[model samples]
Target: MKIITLTFFSALAISVCSLIGPTSRAATGIGDECNKGGDVKFAIREYDNKLVSVCRADGVGDCLYTKAFGKTFVDNRLHLNSDRLHDYVIKDLSGSYGDNDVTHFMLFAQCRDGNFVKVGDDFFTNLRPDAMDRTTGWLKLRVTRDCYNDSISDTQERSYTIVFDPKKRRYGPPDSNPKLTHYCSDAELALPVGSANSSR
Candidate 1:
């Protein structure tokens, strides 16, 4: 049983690392990576690994080293603490977009351009939280002028925050650590969907 679990985690780690790479850099915007300007932050992490900053293309972007709370993004449902990574925080997460309540959540990205031509897709779509029950949470509405620009001009500087009920799973508990994002999240996090949102 121990060997099996270890092998499974190892495999998962290798796979995630491949997808995100040793490091993640936003493209000119979000094409291959992202193009971040001043005041914004970014990060990426593999399963069971700590969140490490790749580098900063812009700003007081200090470097960081820590693990974020959750992994996996899918259908407006994010499973928090599923990893039992119970020592991270999410307040002041870029643009004041985080709170201690940001344990595990989802963001729905849509291109309001009336055409799905450039941007459209569900951000997180993998894994089930072994730490607890799985449920849907958060709903977001957005549009992109240039789906690859780090700096976005919000023709509609508005976004929606939704909480989806598991109905079957009950909302996952909110386990937090106000020290998560502060220490190193502004640069990188295991599952930050900001890049996912900004791309589209």
Candidate 2:
């Protein structure tokens, strides 16, 4: 009876220990590898390991190494960080649009529960790089689109000012007066069903 009881208690303890082990979900996201390998320093780890700027032992030279996502390149020139709105980071990412044009846009991210999550939707799809401007608390971007509505089959450009609202936790259109123009979104530009251009 004593031997059987001991075996039952040992099995219960092993089951509980397995439940206490770290979960796979916790090992995902940006900066997840910061804590691994060699000596390291964290420039920004206030949000846990979810969003961090860390230099590992593999860093070039002596502690001069600073990196974010491994292998994922981020343009330092266009990167922006804000503490007034919850230590969020905005990265300007550039990529090819269609086949010919290259487009630029911004991504807003924040740390939540040891994971980095996107904070907002992009306001400009095809941003004009040369026309982008940033002030103390505002971001202005010029967007271009090849608009084709009825007889209008030409490219148009518009300016927009984006502001962050603390309550909303995302960048959005401004409230005050500004020189800006709103255009039809891609959904609106789609040809109607069975229209003359629908097949094409």
Estimated TM-score per prediction?
0.18, 0.32
Q: Write the per-residue lDDT of candidate 1 for residues 58-101, one digit (tens) a residue.
A: 33355332334332312222213222111111211222222212
Number of the top-ranking candidate, with TM-score as the measure: 2
TM-score of 2: 0.32
Steric clash pairs (candidate 2): none
Instruction: Please report, in order, the local distance difference test score of every candidate based on alpha carbons.
Output: 0.26, 0.35
- lDDT leader: 2
